[model samples]
Target: MFETLPNARRCAVLIAASLAAMGGAAPAFGQAAGQTAMPDSKAGAAKPKLWDARPASPNATINLVHLLVKQGVLTEDQAAGLIKQADDEAYIARQAAKAASTRADEAAKAANAAAAASEPKGTRHVTYVPEIVKRQLREDIKREVMAKAEQENWASPGKYPEWAQRIRFYGDIRGRYQGSFFPTGNDQFDALHFNAVNTGSPYDMASPYNLPTYNTTQNRNQIKLRARLGMEADLTSGFNAGIRIATGESNSPVSTNQTMGGGGSNFSKFGLWLDRGYLTYQAWDRNLVASVGRFDNPFWSPTDLVWHRDLGFDGFAVQGRYAVSDSFTPFGVLGAFPIFNTDFNAGTNLAQLDSKFASRDKWVFGGQVGFSSRFDSYRELRLAAAFYDFENVQGQASQPCYVQSSSDICNTDQTRPLFAQKGNTYMLLRNLQVGSWNNFGTTSLYQYYGLLQQFRPMTVSASLDLGDFHPYHIVLDGEFVWNTAFNRGLAAAGTGLPASVGITSPGVALNNRAASSDGKTVGPFNGGDKGWMARVTVGKKEIRQLGDWSVHAGYKYLESDATVDAFVDSDFGLGGTNLKGYFLGGSYGLSPNVWASLRWLSANNIGGVPYAVDVVLVDLNAKF
Candidate 1:
């Protein structure tokens, strides 16, 4: 129908048809559908109105105009102008939407910041992680890293043994310069046997009643070295094994320092001693441990007042600790250590009736029960009471004779077998008045008496620590010991006699029975049986580098028989009991694992004999 209509009428039909195709309704043109004629606006005498000139629909009109251009009815410039106008509007809409989104993001961020700033301290703003979950996370991360490392072969494939992972090794070395000074030593009890003749004499000097050679001025200096290597291993069934090797002689139990420039040379190779080798079984959630074999000293001592740090024990010990609360723990230690081993000769000799002349070996049975309480992380206190009873520590024999002598005669008062004395007061059990004459020919033969007392020491020690007072710690510790046997020996010194001459065995008797020459029984009560020590330390807990320091000072008064003389400090008063002294020391760290220390000891005999000994030591220590 549009093809048969006039030009103006056909154009109107095309515009309506295009608008209908584009999904828009065309406005009524006021022409009936039955009537074929249509008003022609472009050919009217008056110019068309603005509304009549405008297209019926913008989209359809644009499409119709494109069709007109393609059909050569309109020029290309007219079509290009309409397309540019549509592009500009679409670009403007995209810019406006982008600006709106940016504004929304800024407002959200500002609100979040304001809320965070207004939140108070201790507010539960974050999801909390419990200790258990944190621990689990740590374990998981470790396992995952380990698994990845294994899969990727990051570790050595076969260079090291698998058991190496369970082993830990540690060691330390110390180089020391020591000096000893003695001035005007007057009439001190000579325990070092300086007066006795050994090389020029015809016999070994095994006696204790010998008089002092003569005290004079003595000064000495030497360099010493102490090195130790230790290794510990984890074992099956909650057991662990450890071993330590140190530079010292095997027989010296109280010292591990090896003197330098010995053996008539400037430099001599030192020897290594087996300091410790032990196996420990852990039970009761690792609070209790039972150890056997040669091990470190099990006694708890804050200082070397009662027990030396180098002293090792060959025995078994059981240590246990119970935590009653977070800050209070009670602990106990029980141990049995061998002191001396006696040997019984076979019955090959006809002079002796039987081989079993003596009884058993000497032993030490001891234990300590203690309480450790921590008021907080900054303060602590420990108090322990201990009892040590020695069995067969004192020798038991009436007569000590030498086989080299032609007749059955007691050895000289200066050359008899007795306990090794290192300055402790040892009362002569046997009457040596017969051998008072220097000439051996004038002496009368008599049976000798052995040691007459057993050691049973009761000790109480305590320590307090006030941690981190600024940069230093305040540590105070003290010890008190009462040797029950000391008074027994003193009582025997002036007493008369006992019913019998104790038990007749070598290092096998515990009962102490002393009889004087007149043969009268006496009671057992005397004095001189106490010892005490006190120390104060103010210093850093540990030295990590330069400018770190610690200082300590201590005073100790040891009675004649408070503790074994052999086990006392080897450097104080030249090592032994019956000595009272003051020691001052300071340490400075050179590096994290290296340090230097200086200690000075000024000691005098407890008997007030005007004997003064001063010792100074400077040491450089390194640890790994």
Candidate 2:
């Protein structure tokens, strides 16, 4: 074996011997120039030690094994043994897979044999599934799961829910721009009482200050801001309370207590005073809640401005539902406030303030009694008549001081209260909305103002809904104002009066010539206040999504005699505040939160010329 040793090794040994003969001997496997030529056995042993750095790819590992065999590091048989060992785990997995396949085949075969042996008679058994069907089922299940997740994630208690005593958010904003075309700009109109703001058009070119540019264009802009907030938390489980600041719809709540009206030092703007507030209880499942505080009477009307989501007032009221009979669960409301707005130009002008039995206090008494009906009847209708009792409190009344040759209480020191006649004042009115009353009479409404129809009292009215003959919700309404009288307190007070109802009641004949209070009355009827008007509208509705931006417009007319025997200088000016023309306007939502509105107005002036103006506005809002 020694003689037949590999020549390379023998050569290496000879080289080492020569080196020793020359000087010293070199170690085995040692190459010249300080390099180490590794032996095959050492490399093999080192490879196992290099297992951590072993080639990860199957091809690289295979190449390494082949390299060992070719270098005499391992015999082919030894290499094969190592390969077998390395593949031991893979071999076991293959065996398991093969056995499982074989079992599956046997099971299938057994099942087939059984099915053949147990063949039934006369009936066929078919079982097949399409890939499309499987895919459809998967999609359906996925959709169902996703929908379920979304629903579960999004449910939350919102603010102002009737139940849960949640937070109640209330708010509103009002704004208007006024432009007028009157013979003179010095005139003002407060419809509640006969009075004008100024004597002539403030822009009259005939006046002093010597300006050549004066064309009957009374341009003005107005801004009104109002806010409402309500919150009812569950102090316990069944009780809650809420509050709102009482103010005008066009002004801040910080109104004054003295003189109330528009502009100047008086505290009251836009004239929307407080109208509601209250505490609620639900000991009876909340179905039966009793509320007492400032609350709005449940009367349906476009003017109440409550259905649009942003309008109210301040006054004490109590309302609730009482189960009277199986066929009738009656609801009633009773409210009282010191005063009601008259919609005059400015100043907390009192529309009416009188107690129910006549006292020094101001109060309004009204109620609605309604009963429920079956689905066939749609809903239980109600019949109700309410009144805002008006009374004269000693010297407490409105009086006119000056006259534009058109006022009834102007020129002379003869004082009178325009808000009352004899000793009483108040509205005897009824709700006419279809689906809002029970047994009722039909009523028709038509409003008139200025000249002939000036201050024509509201007709005491009644209304009814005609089952289904008029399915789109047909309704009838009627109203009349009676017992007319002037405010003697005002005539004596010497306050400046508006034309038509001021010292100008008899009208000045181009000079300080004439003045009287004998103008035409609300004609056409009985001896009372006289004439009546009727009106109708289709597709009008209330209870809508309340937004920061909203708009409205309406038309009115009056029935009166053109010829009057009351006063000689009697010339009724239908211009300015006496709106006679029909108008329609609207507002649009720009962003989801920002909005804008535009309106057009029309009316006839004393000069018989039609007057009109256009208004545009933009509003932005934020909530927390």
Best candidate per lDDT, number?
Answer: 1
Tens-digit per-residue lDDT, 69-131, candidate 2: 444444577656655654674578789998997797678778876886798766565545468
Give per-model CA RMSD.
Answer: 19.9, 26.5
- RMSD (CA, Å), candidate 1 to true, equals 19.9
The residue pairs that clash in candidate 1, if any, are: 398-448, 399-448, 496-516
The local distance difference test score of each candidate is 0.65, 0.35
Q: How far is candidate 2 from the true structure (C-alpha RMSD, Å)?
A: 26.5
Question: Could you tell me which 10 consecutive residues in candidate 2 have the lowest summed lDDT?
Answer: 421-430
Assess the local accuracy of residue 417 in candidate 1 as a C-alpha lDDT between 0 and 100: 26
Model 1: lDDT of residue 522: 35
Q: Which candidate is the best by TM-score?
A: 1
Return the TM-score for candidate 2, rounded to 2 decimals: 0.37
TM-score each candidate: 0.64, 0.37
lDDT of 1: 0.65
